[model samples]
Target chain A: MTLSTMRFTEAHEWLRPDEEDPTVVTVGITSHAAEQLGDVVFVELPEPPATVAKDDEVAVIESVKAASEILAPVDGEVLEVNEALADNPGQASEDPMGEGWFFTMKIADPDALAALMTEAAYKAHIGE
Target chain B: MAADLDAARATPLTGMLAELGGKMVSYADHALPVQFAGVMAEHTHTRTAASLFDVSHMGQVTVRGPGAAEALEALIPANLIGLAEGRQRYGLLTNSAGGIEDDLMAARLGPDHFVLVVNGACRDADFALLKAGLPGLEVSMAEDRALIALQGPKAEAALSALWPEAAEMRFMDVREAVVDGISVLVARAGYTGEDGYEISVSAQDATRLAKLLLAQQDVLPAGLGARDSLRLEAGLPLMGNDMGPDVSPAQAGLGWGIPKIRRTGGARAGGFPGADAILAEFENGAARSRVGLRPVGRAPMRAGIVLFADQEGGTPVGEIQSGGFGPTVGGPIAMGRVDAARAQPGTTLYGEMRGKRLPVEVVPLPFTPAQYKR
Candidate 1:
């Protein structure tokens, strides 16, 4: 999917539904959050198949300065995690929107996707 | 709650730091740069090349009078009597209960005159402690001076270009020198585990001196974030983080500061405060000792996390005193107080975070070997 089609969350996460499987959405933190957390060193992703409610603390991203929690933007079951991040967490900061995707989840409720902010709104939300 | 930034005290180099793209933060009621370029970038640069640090917030106290060393010795365990002129020694100000009040660098300038550099947060308390403890000694605060640290493998090359005399000094040596036509006191010591110098100059000339140093080809400005990581890699304990009024010299792995003359069977033994308790721990060993910890995975452990003796259902042993990602180590490293029985190098342990136990191993200190020009 193109950058314009991706949905953004207030918590600095981006979600884009898979073209072949609209029910499955990919998630990753925004570049703004990555910039604030200089030099991402470690990222702890939730195990696949784990169910999480919206706003739940589903992952952790640690940097040289501090550790921050990554919140789940919608209720869903994690289908896959970015295994590559385990070896090189810096990918989260280097290419946060692409290779840095934290996990893919199957949306529990399609209506919840509409509640997230759009790219335009997310940019204004973060004052970027 | 975050501190009011407007009310925080600014150092002499505050404007220079801001101009260098520093991300300012409130630390110990002072406005200081947390990072300039970035934490990891600054840390690695300092290790490989030269980096300048603005440390003006630290207190510089000068004490001179008859029997000054004798009076100061009563407060600390270090053998100040033997600290030769033009030499600096690491020391701790211990309380009556054997707890450390503050860790400082004491430099003997003369037979009865010494200079002390203390933590900024503990400046007032340390000044009061010295005044009240030794009424006869002339204890004056040098508020008009600012301290700057030039650290790393190439520090000498960058510094000696301005002050040729700095190249002749050995580790822990302190002397008055002229740099860029400015009178400054230079110490051949730093917290970064690299051979470097900490220069003390008039507050008015701080910005000018910093600019001159930064103009060097290999020198760049770093901040507190890089400073912390550098010291951690060097296995140096921060005053409030790794040690405090609750931790004694023995428990903090600072027994070396207590010279042999102050220990059992020496010329001067057990004269300082809490000597009985501290010396006993020195001989028999403290119940808990500070040790270096290497987390098994990529995840970095931080301060205040509970440490367990095993991976699962292990007893709570201690807590992390200081921890973070060590850029030089290429992974997460930490220092924590653990049961003495499990504080040995290569001993296996676990760090409990969010109910999950991560395997950690007790390692020797100076996680990276110190490169001092001894």
Candidate 2:
């Protein structure tokens, strides 16, 4: 899916809502963040069914040159993790918005996604 | 060479590196590129092809005079008297307590002249020590020269294409070579555990020489980020990280650098600094030993991670000296100094990362196989 329909955080995390359930959102780091991270070698995603508060550390990405935390945007419980990254973490850089999605979470508030940044806003935020 | 890496703000190639899209970072006090193509990409490229690194920030000094080698031997614990011309030996300057003051490369340029390559941050102190330690010897720090390290499997092919004399040299051979009329000292040695050369050229010709090397089909530009990972994979310890004024040469796993000629009961024995304690450590063993560590998983167990014998941890048994993702080794690797009892390879230890104890095992050094020409 095109990133135009996705929501973004100032920290560069992007969330996409599943059509079947608006409250369930799949999240991944934006391409800008991936590009800035150089090469992603390791990823630590929260276990499914684990509840996290908004802005809590939900995942971690370790690159060859750096380490960074991925915070949860809106409180939620992790629904599923992309286990494929355990085998090939670089995929996060190749398809950051789609196949490289980090996790799917059952967001606490269905309307929280609307409050996040839009595609144009994200581009402006990153000064693209 | 540079004066103090933490005080030296720029190198001759700073502008060139920045113009090439290098991600410049304040390394120590110097502005150096952390990566160009990318740490992982540059690291991988250096494994198969060649990569040029700007190492001008390291200290370059020359101690020359009659009996200069003999005078230097009093401070550095290497067999410098027998260090024949055109040969290079790794040198470590020890302290009164046998702790390593600094690590260096000593090359006998001539019978009465010897050149040294030392760590940038420790240069000023090392030079001052040399001046005081080698009385009547001309100890001079070369400021007009810039150093470049060219490395990889194809390094010979790339350099030999430019200077046919390159193929004739093997590892650890040091000599003067001329490239495009640029008179430079070419040492067939480098930090990376690959077949490589360290070229000492005048600052005025550094940019020009670098451009020529980069034009080679096999050579690409690499920065300090890749240098760290490559050296770590090679099992070479970085000073101030794996060693310091408080770590003995033996404790730093650099005891091998002390040759028999300089050891106790050999010619010129026990004349260098901390000879009593260092020789004792060499024979009896140090309290702690430097070792290679595998973190068992992908997450990098970086420096500052404490090590313990038990997961529950009564007290820390060791600490990581240097660590990062081993792009070639394909996982996280680190070097640490652990208690002598837990130094054996295959011994499992726990490294506390982010308040979590991760399973780590002592592994054989040089996580990736070394391809040194020797």
**Top candidate by DockQ:** 1
Model 2: lDDT of residue B325:
93
Candidate of highest TM-score: 1
Interface RMSD of structure candidate 2 (Å): 0.7
List runs of model 1 lying over 4 Å from the truth: B1-3
Q: List the residue pairs that clash in candidate 1.
A: none
Candidate 1, DockQ score (0 to 1): 0.90
Candidate 1 per-residue lDDT, tens place, B9-39, comes to: 8888888898899988877677789898889
After TM-score superposition, the amount by which residue B274's alpha carbon in candidate 1 deviates from its true location, in angstroms, is 1.1
Worst 10 residues of 2 chain B by lDDT: B1-10
What lDDT does candidate 2 reach at residue B19? 93
Docking class of 2: high
The TM-scores, chain A only, for the candidates as listed are 0.96, 0.95
Candidate 2, DockQ score (0 to 1): 0.84
